[model samples]
Target: MTPFLEFDLRMIIVDRLEKSYGGRTALKGISFRVHRGEVLGLLGPNGAGKTTTMKILTGLIPATGGRASVAGFDVHEQSLEVRRRIGYLPEHPPLYREMTVRGFLRFVAELRGVPRSKRSAKVDRAIEQCGLAEVAGRIVGRLSKGYRQRVGLAQAIVHDPEVLILDEPTVGLDPKQIVDIRSLVKGFGGERTVILSTHILPEVTMTCQRVVIITRGSIVAEDSIANLTGRGEMGERMAITVARDLDGVASTLAGIPGVIGVDRAPGEPPTYHVSVERGFSGKELLSAAVVQSGCGLLEMKTVPETLEDVFLDLITEEHGVAA
Candidate 1:
């Protein structure tokens, strides 16, 4: 007999979820999902509906149309249950500046409905997990911006919810602080589901397993980072740099097998952007052709599209310009 499976693989689901504020639509039927133990990034510019989507998922705000669910509980119909299964750290975390870190987290634990007996242990675990041991007894207001952010994260996870939603978790901190906070966030994957919403592209590139890009209150793209940046409709892009500036380089590369077109990067002499046809894996052929033509091949590497590239393309196409 086969082994029994008890847990659902998908931890969160948003289906055609829509929201409006007064007369403005904040989300235009956006939809996505987060699987168990996965770190998904929600990326967009300001007023792009990332926070709105997160609000709907966390039961902080109701969606005007469609539906969302967390841990198999409908966000609208089973809000309390949904809230119980998720932890949220908004752009500005709810914190009492006068309270010490330990006291604040203990308060959050009690408010989250942890038993009196288990509250200390829960708070301790959260403090440790968020690297707040040194500042546990320090007043929240007295702590550095980085430590305060950690405290905010501690409070969010104090109850050990199945999912964590972090909005701009590293908005205003020093470079070191950003690195430390990023390390902390990166450690949450594979044990708990996380939905990180931020305007920082490098954060998503370094931390998330997959990404969903929203623009003008709608989802413009969603895919694993590799796929989003690697394979395009035209195929992969190879950046070839030659030591000598050979005339007719563009035509020469375009004639090679699997080569679709070629263009020169701005202000980058002797370096050409070669677009390959779909399903083509002929970087070697392209490189050999360049060398055979007597153009000294300095560097040849596949240039995967960056998240910024993908984001600008989608948002520009959607609104006819950057948002």
Candidate 2:
């Protein structure tokens, strides 16, 4: 596919973005893109330039250097147009305590340029879409945290913007509320593009199609969730419980052509979690080695690869290199 179609005219594009606070740099020339119709997870630990990038993308702040464009408009030159095409939910949901959910939504629609005739209909749609119907008449300030968050989401989408930028969308939420918010985000599916920033790895796995991991104010890795997690041939990990001794088990497995590393889990009759190198299938070799060693393989199955592993590995490996 052409680059335009591949990235859908670049829903979010940042080239060598740089920012500094006083003399200390907060961003060191970071750059990445979010494609249309895809939920791209922007992941990093605290101080990783995630929020800084989001702020720049949403026109909250100006970049010290480099270029940015969202929804086909240059962020610097076309800030207003860019804002008009995007929806944003900052870490702190902007809300008015005295305004009911319905009132706040109508105000947001109007601010987004919705016509008077269509404002009510738009507000109603957003309320329903975000599951705010039951709480629509309640004052936003008096609503539960989850309901308030839902109202924030509703306001972001009230104008039907082409792109949605959410920072820490699931932060400070209970398990049930997190699930609800993720479900609401998933409902955005193909109709709008999503650029979500969060430290939560599982959230990225559940809601995002691709991931862009940043660290030290720089882009570290970017790829589809499948590629990042080794859903392809490379990402398979196995946990082996052997009835044999733990001694040298890690080394023996490490010697296998496809085995990456073997770490002993803390316990008796030690079990080891083995990660296979990318593009290597070590299952058969593992079985053979267990059989040859006269060790009974207690259990072995394909465990789903986690974004946490990839995130930690990348960040740790980067630090190791810098050190």
Candidate 3:
């Protein structure tokens, strides 16, 4: 049975987590939580502690300090219990290339503690769930990279664990393969708690409900995709086209209250990009301004802020580093 979609019930928790190697500090007291039956993306640039956090959570390595738990079991103190409740897919698929797809899944199911009598049914469910039924008999080494990823995912889910941790699940996939895997992962909501770690921005937008952005071994931002992109101080952007192409058109639009900045692109029908306060209504004000200014408003459209834009803005704001 799947867990009901409950925000109050947290499935994973990390508190004041720190990690180090030799003289390098990898993670600096990062903290976050994943709700039960939700998809959370741990996003960051390469070497930004995304994988390091995943490794620690999956009990693959020891954390220098702090605490982490999955399904209420401490990752370090209750390693075996934690592992039993979670399915982990690292950056690289740990597939026995020599074994057939079906064989590899059976092996993984057995290793994951599925009883002998239940192994076959569990394996069959995983195969069908991951769209691997067609290639179940093919040798894993002979299958394409896309198929290999499917096998890896199927193996992770064979035991039907409550938590699924995926590190760069679509790292080496082609466009179609990426889309296919995204569709598969997107279907997992409400049935499992998923932590999808990746540097790819679209992956988070397409598959996750919330995100934890890490940079230089620290947590910079954590919130729902809507709140992160919608509540920024950057405000709403607009593109206003003027048919008259009059001088001072930029100034005219800029004079409107709440319109912060305006610039005209070079052309006959000049297009002015206008920046306004986040909650301001721009259409009527802009239309009236352009009409009064005699610039002859042709068209005005809102420019939306995407997750990528928000990510870049956050990275630049947090570290003052250009993206």
Candidate 4:
């Protein structure tokens, strides 16, 4: 097996993928992989080549250079095979406004080459899965934006493709609609590989198993969300509230093995933020040290780093700006 396939049966592969519009390059030799049953978030700012990458992967547009493959078939060489194995929802879903929700889905099923015997079942399944049962009989033009987005999603899945590529799926949704759509996308995990291209950081945190951050037409970082947010690092900061002398508590915590330093939190009485050294996983030792020093441990919790922090730091670094 090739090295890439040896890794984990990659469902999608982009090898030095590049795209250009006239003289301007939209993708600068980017490369990544999406493994079976994994939700990989493609995050980037506006005009950052995110949409371009999605288009290339979905075979909506041909790449200027390099190669891509879906389900082991070349996207450009075996386009039909690739399309048959993948479902695509563009940023603007191509919906026939005059068609009823059920009608649109049935049309999509036929376009996707679903067998006549299975078309009805497939259309029904898509409508139910996307929560469009109530709106199923309504005209597409009369439905709300959220329901329209659901119809788009239903059509994409009508053929039951193995890979689902959604571009800004919840772009125009309300808060509740966004939440509902997120739940639906999360449900696709472990059954279908998904490439979710969006600018919403929280959506990635809630739905994606791994993230690929691109900037200025190139990939800047690719890793699991935890690792990207520094959660995987051995060095950690934990907040602890104790009912004792702040000086004594700080001193005691600093003395614990692996406890590097302790500082009083600004304007917070009896609470100290403890910094643990790298390679240390000694929360228990710190707790024991606190109690032994006559400091009552009221509460102790680790401070988690957010994805927004990571995203900004990376984007800043890519632009050579001091963060």
The TM-score leader among the candidates is 3
On lDDT, who's better, 2 or 3? 3
Residue pairs in steric clash, candidate 2? 230-235
Per-residue lDDT tens digits for candidate 2, residues 1-323, read 11222235568888899998789787889778777787888999988999999899888899999888887678878788888899999988999989999999999999999999999999999998889999999899999888888888888999999999998888888899999999888778688999989998989989998889998888888998888886533456778888876466678788998776777878867578887865666678887887676667787766677778778888997889779
Residues 99-210 of candidate 4: C-alpha lDDT, one tens digit per residue: 9999989999999999999999999999999999888999999989999999988988899999999999999999999999999999998999999988989999999999
Distance (Å) between predicted and true CA of 153, model 4?
0.5
Q: Arrange candidates by lDDT, highest first: which order?
A: 3, 1, 4, 2
What residue runs in model 1 are displaced by over 4 Å at the alpha carbon? Answer: 1-7, 255-257, 281-296, 321-323
**Candidate 3 runs further than 4 Å off:** 1-8, 244-246, 265-269, 281-283, 321-323
Q: What's the distance in Å from true for residue 48, model 1?
A: 1.3
Please, what is the whole-model Cα lDDT of each candidate in the order they appear? 0.87, 0.84, 0.88, 0.87
Question: Cα deviation in Å at residue 62, candidate 3?
Answer: 2.1
lDDT of candidate 1 over 190-217, digit per residue (tens)? 9899999998899999899999999888
Cα TM-score of candidate 2: 0.89
TM-score of each: 0.89, 0.89, 0.90, 0.80
Model 4 score (lDDT): 0.87
Please provide, for model 3 over 196-289, each residue's C-alpha lDDT reduced to its tens digit, 9 standing for 90 to 100.
9999998999999999999988988899999888875679888888777777778877888888898776776688888899888766978898
lDDT at position 291, candidate 1: 88
| Strongest candidate by lDDT | 3
Worst 10 residues of 4 by lDDT: 1-10
| Better by TM-score, candidate 4 or 2 | 2
RMSD of each: 3.9, 3.5, 3.6, 4.5
